[model samples]
Target: MTLDTKKNAFIELGKFLSQFSEKDTIKKKDIVENDLGPLNPTLSQVFFEEFQNLIHLSQSHNGWYTPEQVYFSVQSWSEALTEDNLNQWVGAYDLSAVQPKNIALILAGNIPLVGFHDFLSVLIAGHNVLVKTSSNDQHLLPFLSKCIIAIEPKFANKITFVEGKLENFDAVIATGSNNSARYFDYYFKDKPSIIRKNRNSIAVLNGQETTEQLAALGEDIFRYFGLGCRNVSKIFVPKGYSFVPFFEAIFKYQDVIHYEKYANNYDYNKAVFLMSNFKLLDNGFLTLKEDASYGSPISSVFYEFYENLPDLQTRLQSEGEQIQCIVSNNLVENSIPFGQTQQPKLGDYADNVDTIRFLITIK
Candidate 1:
């Protein structure tokens, strides 16, 4: 596809999502129903158009990719087939380059539709996919594939969803936690693969961040109610940081505190914090605790302070491989950061993975 055609497809997709804006966004009941329903409405007219955008637009990135980047992915898809970037599209190869007969994807279940990109890539790249979706998020995918078949029915057979392994598949791309990474490495050692293990995303907040910056940070921290690995579960703040200003700026999400699962996590963590005598600044919903670890909280997360950039850099260096990207004012020459450690732009993935392009190279 020409770049313009690809871009136009995404614009059309975004336009389809505009309908959601007309509905009652602030209604708690509406939010719940939408998140549980039309949120994944594969056959709905709204979703049909957006799915095309999602497939063509492509949104997986450093963290949860912004909507804009998804659009660009489609526009850039065909470019990967050319020679200049072919080496990258095919990945590093030795001996005779080859294509796999099948590809297996063990998707992570933390966020809404986490494995969708891998599925799209595998299908578009011309390989059969053996998908074992995380049970926690099992509802939306097959519906999505079904919708695609309704659009471009020819693709219906290329993507398959199942609960077990396909021994015939020649390769694998798995997403799992750190512990599972070790298992995947040992289990799939002989097959060529890209196994995504656990990585904690971080936010580096300089003292100069604005109120708007803090508010946006809330989006990064709680988009999936802090369930996603990309959610900024931990943050690095400058010394003498004030939690009040930050909480005040982010208090807009207090309604999320009422979410049953989110509330349960907050209550559980708050009790633990009280017993352990950890300092907390609760605005009735979220809390900020220093010296905390990743995956430690729900409505609330963790943060630590640094004396200077050098000290923070030293600490970050030790955790580099385990980290996806450091969102800060200055992340080295080529490093990227969105407005005050919030959203990541297109192409800021861990290990710099261009996943959609990688999928197309299966052949």
Candidate 2:
């Protein structure tokens, strides 16, 4: 299939996804266009209904995949998969003379549809993809693949989901923890690959942040229950920084404690911290611990006191590999704005590795 054909297919898939969100699922009557023309109405309705069922069924398949979280993910992708966004993202690459290769994708299931960007990247670059879905997030992407195939049957030849061991792929893109990344490194050593290890996002605070910015920062923390690499797992504060304003700003998210899994984590992590005599600041739902680590457990955020901005910037730059995003009021260079980490654009490549540039260059 041509690049335009693949782009239009994904655009249609995005339109189909646009119908569902946390608030409601409403099907539009606009006929989806592919290279061949408009999709059949009956076929469109079938895919729409199937997606609705998948949204509810996702929670049963994985407790962490609550409908609201799933909907948030769906809505984010829907907003991203537009014509302008696609053109802007891919326009930089010269894909005209590319030779199609079989690209393997080993996805992480930390959040809903976490690996969809890699999937989209492979196809948009005119390559076939062999996907191994993480057991924690098995259903959503395959169903979306079906929608893409329905929109453009040629995609059927370009996409494959391996149920057993992965084989017959020229290169690989895998996301996993630090331990698993070691295994991927050893196994895929001979092949050209991108092996991603665990990373965490953090925020830097000078103690002058507004309630609005802090509250928005709460979205960065609590969204997806803090499972995504983009989630702000830690924050940097000045030596005498106060937690009162931060706590008050994030209090609106207290409802998260109502979820049994998160509450269990809160109770368990809090007990562990107390047993070790670690001082913690608690607000009934979330906890703040003065730990130097970047990766924090669920329901808690690690914080460290910084001596100065220059030193902190140098420190963070030195530890860049372990960090995904730095959320600040532009205090640090190239830091993402508060609350925008989770809403990454199409070009926001994970690990700052250019996936498209990697894909098109593969021999």
Candidate 3:
């Protein structure tokens, strides 16, 4: 298929997604000039109905995949799949010379639509994708794949959902925990692959940040209940930094404590830490504990004090592999703006590896 054909197919998919929301969904309208041409009203109704069903089923299957979070994921993708964004993102690489290959994807289930980027990348690169969805997140992407096939029937041949051992694929892109990453590295050693492991995002807080900015940072920390790698699991502050303002800012998310899974983690982790005599700063709903670790348990954020900015930057660079993205008000180099870590653009590949470039070169 031509690049434009693939691009248009995704654009139609975006429109289909745009019709869904947690708040108010739009009424169906006929879209002209799309690859589907005249917007099959019958299929649109079926798609939207299925989308609604999947949203409900998702929360039942994985309690963490709440309807709000699932809708947020859908909205992010709808915004991302615009014609301008898609063209600008893909224009950077010359994909014309890329030969279609069978690319296998092992998806992560921590958050909604976590693996859609790889799924989209493989197809847009003109390759057949063999997707092994995490059982925790099996419904949404397959529903989306159905929408894509409805948009461009030929895409049915380009996308496949696998259940057993992954085979007959030339390359692989797998997302898993640090432990599973070891297995992926060994299993896919001879094949071209990108094996992603656990990486946590951190935030650097300057004493000068506004209350509004700090409140916005709460979204970065609490979105998806802090399960995503892009969620800020830890924060770095200057010496003697006060927790009052930070706690006050994030108080809006106190409702997260109502979730049984998160509340259980909070209560359990708190007891474990207190029993071990670890100093912790608690604000009823969330806990801030001083530690050197980047990975923090649910409902708690690890924090560290930095004496010198340069030294802290050096430390981050040395532990780069353990870090995903940084959120700050430009306090640290290459830090993402507070509250924006989850809204990654197409070019922001996980692990900072260029996935399109990898797909282009996969022989």
Residue 140 C-alpha lDDT in model 1:
49
| CA RMSD per model (angstroms) | 8.7, 1.9, 1.9
lDDT of 2 by residue, 247-275 (tens): 99999999999999999999999999999
Total backbone collisions for each predicted model:
2, 0, 0
What lDDT does candidate 1 reach at residue 143? 54
**lDDT per residue, candidate 3, 167-217, as tens digits?**
999999999999999999999999999999999999998788899899989
Return the TM-score for each candidate structure: 0.72, 0.97, 0.97
lDDT tens per residue, model 1, 112-227: 56676677556545567888888665654665556445444455666778777557777788998888999999999998778887776678877677788778777777776766
Order candidates by lDDT, high to low: 2, 3, 1
* Error in Å for residue 351 of model 1: 5.2
Worst 10 residues of 3 by lDDT: 30-39
Our tally of clashes for model 3 stands at 0
Look at candidate 2 and give me any clashing residue pairs.
none
Model 1 score (lDDT): 0.60
